[model samples]
Target: MSLSPILDLAGLTLEVNHLARGVRFYSQVLGLELARHDEAAGVAEFVVNPHQTLTLWQPITRQANDERLAPLRPRGASHLHYAWQVEPSDLEPSKGLLDAHGLEWQEINLGTEDRPDWTLYFFDPFGHGLELRGVDRADARQPHFAPTPVQRPPHALPVMGLREVALAFSDYPTMKERLPRAYGFALAKEQEDRDFAQFTLGPHPEPDGNGTPRRWLYAWDPQVGLADMLGGDHALVRFYADVDAVGALVVAAGLPCLRDDHGLAVRDPEGHVFEFIAG
Candidate 1:
């Protein structure tokens, strides 16, 4: 059993300059179903999977007038890097889709010869970095979260849901220490050369099978290679977890915890917002 209260990444909200353009790219090109759109509020929500959401927000100047929303307003990072998990078979089709849209894409193999883990990297219309990761599975790994029935769009890229989200940190060491202490994250991988680290939350099974944790949180210095591409300073990253435990931990670690209608939230040193939602 995992001691961490965080179960999974619940949603991600990105800041976009043009809401319509963002919506068209995600819905028409990526095939994510648009769940809700509030034109007046300048927000669009897309169903990434049964349990996850991808939201686009166009910041309004008058948002400060609404006290309840001002704090919760989606001010996310620009050129943020996030990934979606796909089946190995879907990779080629994804390439075709990108090419058809005249979008430039790059592919990299992260796994070995016998088992290949391929990642296709591309950008959205707004320049947010996006990735499609596919791995050949000889043995099926047990899922950490229970399967929920969802109606996927026929033209969608067969995305399994969010695989990872990366955050650019101005002070990587401080943020790194606080995450494990406050959120019960265990360091899974470290690329010191790149000044990046991957952290895993909740119970992970082992060398193979059910022990492998699929979801990841990647933290890297903003000065690093791909991190430099991130234009915005902050983003709203949310997770499904025990709100009480998360709140307590945040306070104990000397981090400021803010609570509103959206549960508990804390800002990292770089101003990136982390919100915890009760499952």
Candidate 2:
């Protein structure tokens, strides 16, 4: 079989209670440029990088007669966990900004003692868990993990792009098997206890060197590690992939999937929605 049709993570959407407050927190506080905001649609999009976007969506209550807007309306998840890639030099400035806004944050080292990669963990106004990851590029595990430089204004945070997005499942065993079997994701790393795993999609620059994939998805059992505190109900994740090829694999695997002219969407056992769009 060929490698997974998934190219990379295209975008992430968070469900927010207030669209205006969400816009202020992401734009004024985090320094992300508000690319577009549609009040009628109750959606706001922020450009994370050239290929990636972060969106905040306020779900509207559907009326009994509003069947036409059902397919067009998207639902978002709350209290989800996601991370952004930042330069090492921006770590202190990030703290300053978070402090200035009176937001409480915690600093931790996710890397080794000799080569430490610091991460700041904090919550948005809506209780969504967010991370600012300053990685050490010299780490031997990911030699090919080079992020493109993003030109930002003076007030903007030094965010390069998204590093990873995590999802917690009630049935970890099924997710462990189904994601790889249906999506062509390669197992990159896993915990000794088998409660958490990291799956990688897309190809690497050097197929023979280091063996690190371009993008990652972190999956874990509910109530394990950070998922215990940050996991939300029914979050939606979107990716850039070959929709037709992925849809074929999902059908061949006997899993339920929805297909249309735009893209393919599938739901896991835990109700997490995975939407694949053609790149």
Candidate 3:
């Protein structure tokens, strides 16, 4: 039997040093509703779809002699790169909304002038990179990944569902080679601009017997690998699985896997953690 990890990218959880600031950006700026927030607990959830959500959390409380904190490193410090996909037409309106708020933003085109799909990028108060990618409504573009209009708070734009997220790495071959070995993700699409490689977790048996996630993981090397340009680590990925099968396969793969109160999880070569929760 051909083996796959039986994974999915249901949602992402980002860590912010300043929980209040993060919550403000995602709510007041992004226009996502504040579904639930517990400031005392330092965690908040934003609804995207009934199934998809964005969570902002703070570092777990530090204990005495926490091994998680290295000699010189800060406790639970994380830098992440994240993106939300939206329809092409929303681009100009979204830009206008951001400008109206006096937020600094910039655009970078990933395609030709006549065939542009631009990405608008900015940052949160603590420096976590945030992106909004516009995928044109062309037949060649996977409609499944194209984001549709989402319900938003009266304060912000109609931020849609996630379509693509990019990770920057120092070595292409290492990531390209390890992705399949560590997990079942493999190259699914290519960019004509030669800026990045797209990997995906194909449809698998949804653990809950419901809709599976349609998502993409992009790896950008060398040209954009500069530390100041991209971020990694502290990004969340939810994978639904046949627990028995995944547990056995994880042990068999022996690829730095871990478990917690949630479920099994494994990180990509770049230290970006993926949390495998129940389908």
Candidate 4:
């Protein structure tokens, strides 16, 4: 029997070194509105939209007090790479915003034949890499998935919200079957590469109406991950939807469960760890 999709992507978490510096980069530099911060817990949360949230937690070793936050390990910063969506018209302003702040950014195309999207890449103070994306995909690929409504504060900042999260896996064939079966993430698009294919899940129209839909992408590359340069195949994701059912599915699948402090932390069949937090 196929399991229902448990996570609605309520939020994504990031591990940073310094709390103050990390806050500065995300809040001041990137312009993400500061939603809440618990200094006692050494965590600062940002509002991505009214629904999906982003969090930065300073590992206990990095912050004061030994008993800090749950799922806390001295794992350094998040090497997990992901992209954020911005308005197509705000693309120039986004670039200008980065340039104005003296933050170095690089641009590249992440689109199909007709739809060419220009994405800007930059790193936060904690070395967590991020992208500001905009696209004009005249020929929309795959079935159209409507974006969930998120009444966020405003698009006043270059950083908008999280979408695609790239993780590493060794077996695509096995994962391709088990992932959707376990999580209900549809196989949206598959772009072939030299070694492995880029498989996207739960892809939809850009939340802001541009760029390739948020990539829930996974590629089989064991070489580079989040440990080095924050390019790891691991990610901690939150489930705003069916939390209990998802956790049960992880056990039923016989995949490894690493930690479950604040949520159900489990590895895929390929051994990529993701924290399934219930928001």
Candidate 5:
């Protein structure tokens, strides 16, 4: 049964091998602010956005051996990559900034060879693939695809109005009891045989906002056990950007196109993957 109402998704949380390094990389490179840090606990939370948090912590020693770091190993392969969007104009300057920092980057064509929109790609310190894109493309020749909406909820809604997540959990009962209370997420619905459930994104319906509620799914599986639920070691951090901003940031980052068919992928120093998409 549902125990409490839905709360905002505060951000993604990840336990890293090196806390200090992660903090430095995110702050200096990505421009995330350090919301808070507990020196005694060695836990820090970076506010990626109003709704998103990048959490970092480290144990006395990491359990994963050198063998676990094998590039193509399946033991802990992350199937998904996150996409971060930037403004179109910001692409150039962003690439410049990245190049100054000694990071490699590239440009991308979103549509088919005959018709394509240029995009940018780079990696974070954790090997997470990140993309910066524009809200709309200028090339009339490029295939026309509708733009994804900007995902910001009203402030008046419930605890920050965070709605979407793809968490991996094991027990349904424990999650039913705990998640809603902690994250301000409500039980929009659930799917039993599919091994997952869903929560509404954004705040509860309010009088002024026109946006409809969106539902996000969370898949529970043995691979994503309870202990490994919150920080599954495999996560994608999404960044939002408009068309002009996408170009500015891309150029500043000095990145390159990933491939012809897909967005670019790069490795951060720690090896986590992030993919970028338009907001």
Candidate 6:
């Protein structure tokens, strides 16, 4: 079957408590290249690749004059989850690097379900959950046996291309009802609540050329309770032309901005937390 024209995974923007410290870690350790830094706006971008980007801004200290952070129980993290591609051979070496850095992670074995065999899950210095998976398999019944030679490429954190965002939510059903009402998203697909639910948001036609629009999924996290305290209790996926586009959306929505930590801030519809911003 043809695939739908899914939303391009454009990258994620996060708030940092210390700008210099944050930059130092991601650059020196992860080898990410800085594309831009605007001290005036207190914003910086790490090029993840040609299309993907990671933006970091100063943290919010004073209570927001605009909106408040979503009011939910702390899930003991500030991690924004993202998945990356890896090769079978590189897995061991990559894990070594993670170990050297004292990063903790879990191994998720696919067992020949998808083309990829193993996926390594870990958290960044800032606690963002990241997954790197082998692009190919090594099983006897699978395609290849020999490990492919690979080379490390220069890292770029550009604006991420069309991709999906796994947003954390406190209530799946409430999100299912309130998200569609507050934003312009039509439900595309859903899975049983495994502590979360995935819902499609946005407009991009499917690959069949039948004009079935592309959309994004909102993955709910029941462990997260700060939807109100974080200001954006609910998360929705959509495309923005740039940072300006992000501002425009907030204003247009008529949602009150409870807090602004420069690039990362909280806006409210009572229970939604809009944290990830991209162009």
Candidate 6: deviation at residue 11, Å? 2.5
Q: After superposing candidate 6, which stretches have Cα over 4 Å from the reference?
A: 1-6, 38-42, 60-77, 87-90, 110-117, 134-164, 180-189, 193-195, 200-218, 224-279
Alpha-carbon local distance difference test for all models: 0.71, 0.71, 0.60, 0.56, 0.42, 0.46
State candidate 6's TM-score: 0.58
Candidates by TM-score, descending order: 1, 2, 3, 4, 6, 5
Q: Estimate, for each residue in 1-279, the C-alpha lDDT of model 6 and write its tens digit.
A: 222222244556555566677787677546667887765445677766554566775544443312334342111124555455444466667776777667776776645454335656766566555665454333322211122222333332111122335666555566666554443334555645454444443342222111112224445554532212111223322233233444545556675543244343334443434543343
**Candidate 5 global CA lDDT score:** 0.42
Q: Which stretches of candidate 3 lie over 4 Å from their true place?
A: 1-8, 60-77, 136-146, 168-172, 189-196, 203-214, 221-228, 240-248, 256-262, 267-270
What are the models' TM-scores? 0.86, 0.84, 0.74, 0.71, 0.42, 0.58
Tell me which of candidates 4 and 5 scores higher on lDDT. 4
User: In terms of TM-score, which candidate is stronger, 2 or 6?
Assistant: 2
Pick by TM-score: 5 or 6, better one:
6
Residue lDDT tens for model 5, 1-279: 532222223344454556688787766766666887665455677765444556564443333321222231112223222334344555667677777668887776655676555656665555444455453333322111212233232211011122334544456566554434433344556654655655543234221111222323353443532212232334433322232333334334443313112232322222333233333
Regarding TM-score, does 1 or 2 come out ahead?
Answer: 1
Give per-residue CA lDDT, model 3, range 148-243, as digits (tens): 577776558666776545666677777776665555555665556665667664443111101112456767763443225464553555655545
By summed lDDT, which 10 consecutive residues of candidate 2 come out lowest?
Answer: 204-213
Best by TM-score: 1
lDDT of 2 at 247: 84
The number of clashing residue pairs in each candidate reads: 2, 0, 0, 6, 74, 63
Instruction: Please report, as a residue range, the 10-residue window in candidate 6 with the lowest summed lDDT.
Output: 206-215
